[model samples]
Target: MRQLLAPALLVAGLLLSGCAGFQPLYAQPGVTRDLGAIEVTAPAGRTGYLMRQHLDDAFAKNHSVAPRYTMDLALAEARYPRGVRIDNVATRYEYVLTVTYVLKDLPSGAVARRGRVRVELTYDSADQPYASISAQQDAQDRATDEAARRIELELAAWLGTTAKVAAK
Candidate 1:
Protein backbone atom coordinates (compact mmCIF):
# COMPACT_ATOMS: atom_id res chain seq x y z
CA MET A 1 0.00 0.00 0.00
CA ARG A 2 2.85 2.43 0.79
CA GLN A 3 4.55 1.71 -2.52
CA LEU A 4 1.25 2.14 -4.36
CA LEU A 5 0.69 5.50 -2.64
CA ALA A 6 4.12 6.77 -3.75
CA PRO A 7 3.49 5.80 -7.37
CA ALA A 8 0.01 7.32 -7.29
CA LEU A 9 1.38 10.65 -6.03
CA LEU A 10 4.01 10.69 -8.73
CA VAL A 11 1.40 9.98 -11.39
CA ALA A 12 -0.79 12.75 -10.13
CA GLY A 13 2.10 15.19 -10.17
CA LEU A 14 2.99 14.24 -13.71
CA LEU A 15 -0.58 14.61 -14.87
CA LEU A 16 -0.79 18.02 -13.30
CA SER A 17 2.52 19.06 -14.76
CA GLY A 18 1.48 17.78 -18.15
CA CYS A 19 -0.87 20.73 -18.28
CA ALA A 20 2.18 22.97 -18.08
CA GLY A 21 3.82 21.29 -21.07
CA PHE A 22 0.64 21.09 -23.14
CA GLN A 23 1.42 24.48 -24.69
CA PRO A 24 -0.77 25.50 -27.57
CA LEU A 25 0.67 26.74 -30.80
CA TYR A 26 -0.86 30.18 -30.29
CA ALA A 27 -1.47 30.99 -26.65
CA GLN A 28 -0.78 29.01 -23.51
CA PRO A 29 -2.41 25.67 -22.76
CA GLY A 30 -5.72 26.50 -21.13
CA VAL A 31 -5.31 30.09 -22.27
CA THR A 32 -5.73 29.06 -25.90
CA ARG A 33 -8.18 30.89 -28.17
CA ASP A 34 -10.14 27.80 -29.16
CA LEU A 35 -8.97 24.30 -29.83
CA GLY A 36 -9.40 24.22 -33.61
CA ALA A 37 -11.51 27.35 -33.95
CA ILE A 38 -13.34 29.41 -31.37
CA GLU A 39 -16.90 30.26 -30.42
CA VAL A 40 -18.26 33.48 -28.85
CA THR A 41 -20.95 34.22 -26.32
CA ALA A 42 -21.96 37.30 -24.37
CA PRO A 43 -23.77 37.85 -21.14
CA ALA A 44 -27.53 37.97 -20.91
CA GLY A 45 -28.99 41.34 -22.04
CA ARG A 46 -25.57 42.53 -23.25
CA THR A 47 -24.74 43.44 -26.84
CA GLY A 48 -21.02 42.69 -27.06
CA TYR A 49 -21.38 40.11 -29.78
CA LEU A 50 -18.87 42.21 -31.63
CA MET A 51 -16.29 41.38 -29.02
CA ARG A 52 -16.48 37.73 -29.88
CA GLN A 53 -16.70 38.57 -33.54
CA HIS A 54 -13.53 40.61 -33.35
CA LEU A 55 -11.73 37.69 -31.78
CA ASP A 56 -13.08 35.38 -34.44
CA ASP A 57 -12.02 37.74 -37.15
CA ALA A 58 -8.63 38.15 -35.58
CA PHE A 59 -8.10 34.43 -35.21
CA ALA A 60 -9.20 33.78 -38.74
CA LYS A 61 -7.03 36.55 -40.02
CA ASN A 62 -4.04 35.17 -38.19
CA HIS A 63 -4.52 31.45 -38.75
CA SER A 64 -6.79 31.35 -41.80
CA VAL A 65 -8.79 28.70 -39.99
CA ALA A 66 -12.01 29.01 -38.10
CA PRO A 67 -11.69 28.60 -34.38
CA ARG A 68 -12.71 25.19 -33.05
CA TYR A 69 -15.69 26.28 -30.97
CA THR A 70 -16.73 29.50 -32.64
CA MET A 71 -20.31 28.93 -31.71
CA ASP A 72 -19.44 28.46 -28.07
CA LEU A 73 -17.10 31.46 -27.90
CA ALA A 74 -19.67 33.23 -25.83
CA LEU A 75 -18.30 31.08 -23.07
CA ALA A 76 -15.00 32.82 -23.60
CA GLU A 77 -16.17 36.32 -24.38
CA ALA A 78 -14.31 38.98 -22.44
CA ARG A 79 -14.81 42.60 -23.49
CA TYR A 80 -17.45 44.50 -25.44
CA PRO A 81 -17.34 47.51 -27.74
CA ARG A 82 -19.80 50.39 -27.74
CA GLY A 83 -21.52 51.14 -30.99
CA VAL A 84 -20.57 53.79 -33.51
CA ARG A 85 -20.47 57.20 -31.94
CA ILE A 86 -21.47 60.13 -34.09
CA ASP A 87 -21.21 63.16 -31.83
CA ASN A 88 -19.43 64.44 -28.77
CA VAL A 89 -22.54 63.90 -26.70
CA ALA A 90 -20.94 60.49 -26.40
CA THR A 91 -23.57 57.82 -26.66
CA ARG A 92 -22.28 55.73 -23.83
CA TYR A 93 -22.40 51.92 -23.68
CA GLU A 94 -20.54 49.23 -21.79
CA TYR A 95 -19.33 45.76 -22.64
CA VAL A 96 -18.42 43.35 -19.88
CA LEU A 97 -17.08 39.99 -21.02
CA THR A 98 -15.13 37.75 -18.71
CA VAL A 99 -14.35 34.05 -18.48
CA THR A 100 -12.21 32.08 -16.11
CA TYR A 101 -8.96 31.36 -17.89
CA VAL A 102 -5.89 29.39 -17.01
CA LEU A 103 -2.61 30.01 -18.73
CA LYS A 104 0.44 27.76 -19.07
CA ASP A 105 1.76 28.93 -15.70
CA LEU A 106 0.20 32.27 -14.95
CA PRO A 107 0.26 33.59 -11.46
CA SER A 108 -3.03 33.25 -9.52
CA GLY A 109 -3.79 30.64 -12.19
CA ALA A 110 -5.62 33.39 -14.11
CA VAL A 111 -4.88 35.80 -16.88
CA ALA A 112 -5.00 39.52 -16.20
CA ARG A 113 -6.60 39.54 -19.60
CA ARG A 114 -9.88 39.61 -17.73
CA GLY A 115 -11.14 38.82 -21.24
CA ARG A 116 -12.29 42.44 -21.17
CA VAL A 117 -11.07 44.87 -23.81
CA ARG A 118 -12.57 48.32 -23.99
CA VAL A 119 -13.56 49.65 -27.42
CA GLU A 120 -14.40 53.29 -27.02
CA LEU A 121 -14.72 55.52 -30.06
CA THR A 122 -14.88 59.16 -29.16
CA TYR A 123 -16.05 61.80 -31.63
CA ASP A 124 -15.65 65.39 -30.55
CA SER A 125 -18.00 67.18 -32.90
CA ALA A 126 -18.74 69.34 -29.93
CA ASP A 127 -15.21 70.61 -30.16
CA GLN A 128 -15.81 71.72 -33.73
CA PRO A 129 -19.25 73.27 -33.59
CA TYR A 130 -18.91 73.84 -37.34
CA ALA A 131 -18.52 70.12 -38.02
CA SER A 132 -21.24 68.51 -40.14
CA ILE A 133 -23.18 65.44 -39.01
CA SER A 134 -21.74 63.44 -41.90
CA ALA A 135 -18.26 64.53 -40.95
CA GLN A 136 -18.83 63.54 -37.36
CA GLN A 137 -20.12 60.19 -38.34
CA ASP A 138 -17.29 59.65 -40.72
CA ALA A 139 -14.79 60.59 -38.08
CA GLN A 140 -16.54 58.30 -35.68
CA ASP A 141 -16.29 55.49 -38.14
CA ARG A 142 -12.61 56.07 -38.43
CA ALA A 143 -12.41 56.09 -34.69
CA THR A 144 -14.27 52.84 -34.54
CA ASP A 145 -11.91 51.37 -37.06
CA GLU A 146 -9.00 52.57 -35.01
CA ALA A 147 -10.60 51.14 -31.92
CA ALA A 148 -10.87 47.76 -33.54
CA ARG A 149 -7.22 47.85 -34.42
CA ARG A 150 -6.42 48.85 -30.88
CA ILE A 151 -8.32 45.88 -29.53
CA GLU A 152 -6.61 43.51 -31.91
CA LEU A 153 -3.23 44.90 -31.02
CA GLU A 154 -4.02 44.53 -27.37
CA LEU A 155 -5.05 40.92 -27.83
CA ALA A 156 -1.91 40.25 -29.78
CA ALA A 157 0.16 41.69 -27.00
CA TRP A 158 -1.61 39.44 -24.54
CA LEU A 159 -0.94 36.39 -26.69
CA GLY A 160 2.60 37.50 -27.29
CA THR A 161 3.24 37.79 -23.61
CA THR A 162 1.97 34.27 -23.14
CA ALA A 163 4.21 32.96 -25.87
CA LYS A 164 7.19 34.76 -24.41
CA VAL A 165 6.56 33.00 -21.15
CA ALA A 166 6.33 29.65 -22.92
CA ALA A 167 9.72 30.13 -24.60
CA LYS A 168 11.22 30.39 -21.15
Candidate 2:
Protein backbone atom coordinates (compact mmCIF):
# COMPACT_ATOMS: atom_id res chain seq x y z
CA MET A 1 0.00 0.00 0.00
CA ARG A 2 2.82 2.43 0.79
CA GLN A 3 4.41 1.87 -2.63
CA LEU A 4 1.14 2.65 -4.40
CA LEU A 5 0.42 5.68 -2.26
CA ALA A 6 3.27 7.83 -3.69
CA PRO A 7 2.34 7.00 -7.30
CA ALA A 8 -1.29 7.85 -6.64
CA LEU A 9 -0.31 11.15 -5.06
CA LEU A 10 1.95 11.99 -8.02
CA VAL A 11 -0.85 11.28 -10.46
CA ALA A 12 -3.24 13.42 -8.46
CA GLY A 13 -0.75 16.27 -8.42
CA LEU A 14 -0.21 16.03 -12.15
CA LEU A 15 -3.97 16.16 -12.77
CA LEU A 16 -4.36 19.17 -10.52
CA SER A 17 -1.53 20.92 -12.33
CA GLY A 18 -3.25 20.23 -15.62
CA CYS A 19 -6.43 21.83 -14.33
CA ALA A 20 -4.51 25.05 -13.64
CA GLY A 21 -2.82 25.18 -17.06
CA PHE A 22 -5.34 23.30 -19.13
CA GLN A 23 -5.44 24.86 -22.57
CA PRO A 24 -7.01 22.96 -25.41
CA LEU A 25 -4.49 20.56 -26.92
CA TYR A 26 -5.87 21.22 -30.38
CA ALA A 27 -4.31 24.70 -30.36
CA GLN A 28 -1.37 24.43 -32.74
CA PRO A 29 2.02 24.70 -31.10
CA GLY A 30 4.48 27.55 -31.87
CA VAL A 31 1.73 29.40 -33.71
CA THR A 32 0.70 32.67 -32.12
CA ARG A 33 0.06 36.24 -33.28
CA ASP A 34 -0.34 36.01 -37.01
CA LEU A 35 -1.43 39.67 -37.01
CA GLY A 36 -2.96 39.40 -40.45
CA ALA A 37 -5.24 42.23 -41.50
CA ILE A 38 -8.90 41.59 -42.21
CA GLU A 39 -11.55 43.65 -44.01
CA VAL A 40 -15.28 43.26 -43.39
CA THR A 41 -17.84 44.67 -45.81
CA ALA A 42 -21.52 45.16 -45.13
CA PRO A 43 -24.44 47.10 -46.62
CA ALA A 44 -25.46 50.77 -46.51
CA GLY A 45 -27.22 52.78 -43.73
CA ARG A 46 -27.45 52.33 -39.95
CA THR A 47 -28.42 48.70 -40.06
CA GLY A 48 -25.42 47.98 -42.23
CA TYR A 49 -23.14 49.90 -39.92
CA LEU A 50 -24.43 47.93 -36.97
CA MET A 51 -23.80 44.73 -38.84
CA ARG A 52 -20.30 45.89 -39.62
CA GLN A 53 -19.68 46.51 -35.95
CA HIS A 54 -20.93 43.05 -35.15
CA LEU A 55 -18.67 41.49 -37.77
CA ASP A 56 -15.59 43.38 -36.66
CA ASP A 57 -16.03 42.42 -33.00
CA ALA A 58 -16.88 38.83 -33.78
CA PHE A 59 -13.86 38.44 -36.05
CA ALA A 60 -11.48 39.84 -33.48
CA LYS A 61 -12.93 37.81 -30.62
CA ASN A 62 -13.12 34.54 -32.51
CA HIS A 63 -9.62 34.72 -34.00
CA SER A 64 -8.03 33.31 -30.87
CA VAL A 65 -5.41 31.16 -32.53
CA ALA A 66 -4.17 33.96 -34.78
CA PRO A 67 -3.65 37.56 -33.73
CA ARG A 68 -5.26 39.99 -36.13
CA TYR A 69 -3.19 42.91 -37.40
CA THR A 70 -6.13 45.13 -38.37
CA MET A 71 -9.83 44.77 -39.15
CA ASP A 72 -12.10 46.89 -41.37
CA LEU A 73 -15.82 46.88 -42.24
CA ALA A 74 -16.96 48.70 -45.35
CA LEU A 75 -20.60 49.59 -45.85
CA ALA A 76 -21.66 48.39 -49.27
CA GLU A 77 -24.97 47.23 -50.73
CA ALA A 78 -27.25 44.60 -49.21
CA ARG A 79 -29.85 42.50 -51.00
CA TYR A 80 -31.52 40.05 -48.70
CA PRO A 81 -32.73 36.79 -50.12
CA ARG A 82 -36.41 36.19 -49.39
CA GLY A 83 -37.02 34.48 -46.07
CA VAL A 84 -38.88 31.24 -45.78
CA ARG A 85 -42.53 31.68 -44.93
CA ILE A 86 -42.87 30.96 -41.23
CA ASP A 87 -45.78 28.88 -39.99
CA ASN A 88 -48.18 29.83 -37.17
CA VAL A 89 -47.58 33.52 -38.08
CA ALA A 90 -47.85 34.46 -34.44
CA THR A 91 -45.59 37.50 -34.84
CA ARG A 92 -46.95 40.94 -35.79
CA TYR A 93 -43.75 42.49 -37.06
CA GLU A 94 -41.13 40.11 -38.46
CA TYR A 95 -37.50 40.84 -37.79
CA VAL A 96 -34.61 39.70 -39.93
CA LEU A 97 -30.89 40.42 -39.79
CA THR A 98 -28.35 39.45 -42.41
CA VAL A 99 -24.61 39.75 -41.98
CA THR A 100 -21.81 39.25 -44.49
CA TYR A 101 -18.11 39.56 -43.74
CA VAL A 102 -15.07 39.37 -45.95
CA LEU A 103 -11.52 39.02 -44.72
CA LYS A 104 -8.68 40.22 -46.90
CA ASP A 105 -4.95 39.92 -46.64
CA LEU A 106 -3.76 43.52 -46.60
CA PRO A 107 -0.33 43.31 -48.20
CA SER A 108 -1.20 40.48 -50.52
CA GLY A 109 -4.47 42.03 -51.72
CA ALA A 110 -6.21 38.68 -51.58
CA VAL A 111 -9.38 37.41 -50.03
CA ALA A 112 -8.67 35.15 -47.08
CA ARG A 113 -12.13 34.38 -45.81
CA ARG A 114 -15.75 35.24 -46.48
CA GLY A 115 -18.90 34.23 -44.60
CA ARG A 116 -22.55 35.22 -44.31
CA VAL A 117 -25.01 34.68 -41.48
CA ARG A 118 -28.72 35.49 -41.36
CA VAL A 119 -31.27 35.30 -38.57
CA GLU A 120 -35.05 35.77 -38.62
CA LEU A 121 -37.00 36.54 -35.48
CA THR A 122 -40.72 36.10 -34.92
CA TYR A 123 -42.76 37.45 -32.03
CA ASP A 124 -46.33 36.72 -31.06
CA SER A 125 -48.86 39.41 -32.03
CA ALA A 126 -50.57 39.26 -28.67
CA ASP A 127 -47.32 40.12 -26.95
CA GLN A 128 -46.95 43.40 -28.86
CA PRO A 129 -48.63 46.80 -27.90
CA TYR A 130 -48.33 45.73 -24.27
CA ALA A 131 -45.65 48.39 -23.75
CA SER A 132 -43.07 45.72 -24.54
CA ILE A 133 -42.28 46.03 -28.22
CA SER A 134 -38.80 47.22 -27.35
CA ALA A 135 -38.27 44.10 -25.30
CA GLN A 136 -39.17 42.00 -28.30
CA GLN A 137 -36.69 43.91 -30.45
CA ASP A 138 -34.00 43.34 -27.86
CA ALA A 139 -34.77 39.66 -27.82
CA GLN A 140 -34.60 39.49 -31.58
CA ASP A 141 -31.30 41.35 -31.61
CA ARG A 142 -29.90 38.93 -29.05
CA ALA A 143 -30.91 35.98 -31.16
CA THR A 144 -29.39 37.53 -34.25
CA ASP A 145 -26.18 38.26 -32.41
CA GLU A 146 -25.97 34.67 -31.27
CA ALA A 147 -26.40 33.39 -34.76
CA ALA A 148 -23.73 35.72 -36.13
CA ARG A 149 -21.43 34.75 -33.26
CA ARG A 150 -21.73 31.06 -34.02
CA ILE A 151 -21.07 31.60 -37.70
CA GLU A 152 -18.07 33.78 -37.01
CA LEU A 153 -16.70 31.28 -34.52
CA GLU A 154 -16.77 28.55 -37.11
CA LEU A 155 -15.21 30.80 -39.73
CA ALA A 156 -12.43 31.84 -37.39
CA ALA A 157 -11.59 28.26 -36.57
CA TRP A 158 -11.23 27.51 -40.22
CA LEU A 159 -9.20 30.64 -40.81
CA GLY A 160 -6.85 29.76 -37.99
CA THR A 161 -6.31 26.30 -39.36
CA THR A 162 -5.68 27.65 -42.82
CA ALA A 163 -3.32 30.34 -41.62
CA LYS A 164 -1.33 27.89 -39.57
CA VAL A 165 -0.96 25.51 -42.48
CA ALA A 166 -0.12 28.29 -44.88
CA ALA A 167 2.50 29.73 -42.59
CA LYS A 168 4.26 26.41 -42.45
Each candidate structure's TM-score, on Cα atoms with residue i matched to residue i, is 0.34, 0.51
lDDT (Cα atoms) of all candidates against the true structure:
0.43, 0.53
Number of backbone collisions per candidate: 17, 1
Q: How many pairs of residues collide in model 2?
A: 1
Tens-place lDDT digits, model 2, residues 1-168: 999999999999998988985544235442223322234455566555565566556645334334343333332222222333466434344556555556566566566666666666654444346645564546455654665576566665675677568778
After superposing candidate 1 on the true structure, give the runs of residues whose Cα lies further than 4 Å from its correct spot: 1-64, 68-112, 115-131
Candidates' RMSD to native: 16.6, 7.6
Count steric clashes of candidate 1. Answer: 17
5-90, model 1: which lDDT tens digit per residue?
A: 99999999989987985644354543344332433443443233444444456545336654333222222322233443665344
Q: Candidate 1, after superposition: displacement of residue 136 in Å?
A: 2.5
